[model samples]
Target: MAKSVENQVEQTKVLPQYVAALVANLLVASVGCAMSWTSPTLLKMDSGETDIPASSDEKSWIGSLTPLGAVFSPFLAGYTADRWGRKTTLIATACPVIVGWVLIACAEPARSIPLIYVGRIIHGLCLGVAFTVIPMYCGEIAEDKVRGALGSFLQIFVSLGSLSQYAVGPYVSYLVLTIFSATVPFLFAVTMWFIPESPYQHVMAGEEQKALEALQWLRGTSVEAVKEELAIIKENVREKMENKSTPRDLISTKASVTALYLSMGLLGLQIFTGIDAILFYCQDIFAASGGDLDSSVSTIIVGMVMLLASACTPFIVESLGRRILLLISAAGMAVSLALIGTFFHLLNNNSDTSSIGWLPVVSLVIYMIVFSIGFGPVPWAVMGELFAPNVKSMASSIATSFCWFLAFLVTNFFPTISKELGSDYAFWIFGIFAVVAFVSVFFLLPETKGKSLQEIQAILGG
Candidate 1:
């Protein structure tokens, strides 16, 4: 056993390989999130050159398709990862993203809108696959102590990608931006070819010896530690296999079902609060608020603020705990949205342009900061923590699907809602969602801070 353990340790010490995998994972996630930022700019550019309806309804429909793709892609990718393996699924997903970007780049200015939707749908599908698989892959490979920090990097990179779009969009045409963005996914796919499969997936496939070897290579840990982890993984797999239920079995138990519901609700709240709407359409929002602000500059600033807040998350997430952060952030978001809504309401009601002078900008900045600190990081991080290994993929898929679905609703309705309900009422609606999210976090969210994935699973199981 000692010799075997020593062999495992020696095999797993391939630090370079792991680092490469981490980089690839980050690239994949970055490309996924960057799409959100790029699409609006691209659409605006296309609108300028085309005679397409350019109506609110048309814009919303375009926005809605991507999330619609996101809602379903995860289920397909999750199962594919389980059946086909993470590395293969990631590579396959990359192809569509690359194709999407290339198609977007080649589309004629006159023919671009529909092609743009196609590209978004394809990209959203890639995002769904990448989002589900990347975290699970990272979780499986990460050292227990550093898992939270490493896993949290997904959001950080996502923020960076978002920020990159804002920074890059004004300087480049849509075609150039699309071409540049394609490199991320293309490189991610190429790099992933050199990485090892997730050891957990190896173990799930009943390839214990391979699992041990993979874990040793990926983790660079002692044989004893690898064996201990392997045992835990095997037991989880055994339980899953013995149950003989489909993924739906995950929520068959009341507790598990409640957890799933709450997780989905949390994800839904993230979208329903109109964070994406505000982020994607910031220029419009600012213009509506009567600001003479340059849309691109304001967007870049917002993106920078988001990136800064995300950067701070890893430092505090493990120490401060997930629940508290969620509540605080939700409360902060509520107030900010209320302020934004009130400003817009005042403007709409009395045409009082003074309220938008500085307050709207300040409120938006504050709201972005608050959102970045809490909801931005906690949702993905907690989603990583909430589901048990057996059902994690399925639960994540369902939750993510719900999230995208609500995102579709919010993005699709934002223009109409703001137009009819007025921007103030629209923001007020988001404020109400934040308030509800605050309550949910206080009551339902578990504190998974400083806990390993296995430890979190145990807590959730009870």
Candidate 2:
């Protein structure tokens, strides 16, 4: 009996799921590169080092357009994912992003800022699809035991993509970087062509045979290895689809409405953590830091810190439990943001911050570390976990789209606020948001660490 049990455990293959998750996230990483592209390239534009001309206002619009484009597309994305399949949605979305990058690559030769705007908007539109479907696919395909770890790959890959841009953008020409960015979605498309659709998605489409095969493929094991799991998936899909999930259904029930609120609030606070402003304007923020480190080097260092933090999260998130990690992460970010605000405040007043030139980097490093572990990835994971499976798809689209809309507001106005009001005021405002997030985590957030999706929904259902 003991030998049989050990053999059963050894035969359970998880590597294939991990590989699929990683491949699916390649497009997400490209989104990151597009996000941070403006960070380095904006610097060149600001200083007239590039042939393309953008006034500060136009630059802000360029920086903010992706999120704005994202704001309007998630509902459509959800519709497509539900009707077609997660795999198809991911594959189809790649086309627009590739076109977007190509437009940006060609913009330099034309010296047209309008071309860049159109490219960014197109990229953003597709990104809404990526954000909507990726989490659904990741959460459904994973076993509950490893869901958090796998789900975190969403943010981890985003950071990895952004890090690649930060590390490479400063050294390369605009055309070279844009060309490289366009290639990422193509690679994602190629790799995704070979992976199976989520078993849950297949079940939703009433294809039990395909669902079984997909689960078997994703688990990298025989039918026997995944039989029980496939049964559970089928049962859940049947229950959830008694009434088809639609946007109107999201707010029809009290429990689902609460879940939607939780989703929006959780993800909304993540954006208010000032991550968009920090990432989009990383080079400028560092330049404003008055630090001894070169601005380009400083941006790279921050990107590295963010990437490492995001990578380490999946390893520890399960152990720490969701609420505790969030509490710690929120408090840490609040303090870090306050310290950064103080540094800026002092520097603005001519208080000679030469003695503490390192403060900004240290604070932001700490911010990235704590933010990555909890507020950064937990919201998306928990968002998927807490909703009733019936409303999950629509709920995800609303929450994700709302998050990007808030991101647009922040990214669009950050430059004006920093230059006109003061950078210190901006950081202080972000710090206050962090404080609210900490309180919310302590009082309202549930610890979702070891729970299955059904279990999580039960908690929210009450």
* lDDT (Cα, 0-100) at 124 in candidate 1: 74
Q: lDDT of each model, Cα atoms only? A: 0.74, 0.86
The local distance difference test score of model 2 is 0.86
RMSD of each: 3.7, 2.6
Q: Which stretches of candidate 2 lie over 4 Å from their true place?
A: 1-10, 206-209, 224-228, 246-249, 446-462
What tens digits encode model 1's per-residue C-alpha lDDT throughout 367-409? 8887877888788777756766566666777788888888878
Model 1 regions more than 4 Å off: 1-21, 30-34, 38-43, 46-53, 205-213, 220-240, 247-251, 349-356, 383-389, 443-462
Candidate 2 residue pairs in clash (backbone atoms < 3 Å): none
TM-score of each: 0.86, 0.92
What TM-score quantifies how close candidate 1 is to the native fold? 0.86
Enumerate clash totals for all models, in the order shown: 2, 0
- Candidate 2 per-residue lDDT, tens place, 1-462, comes to 566445545676778888888999998998888888898899888776689989989999999999999999899987788899999999998988999998898888899999999999998898788887887788788876677677888888889888888898888888888888888999999999999999988888888889889887876777766667777887877777685766777877766877888889988999998999999999889988879888888888899999999999888776788788888888999999999999999999999999999999889899999999889888877776688766766777778889999999999999999989899999999999999999988888777787877677677777
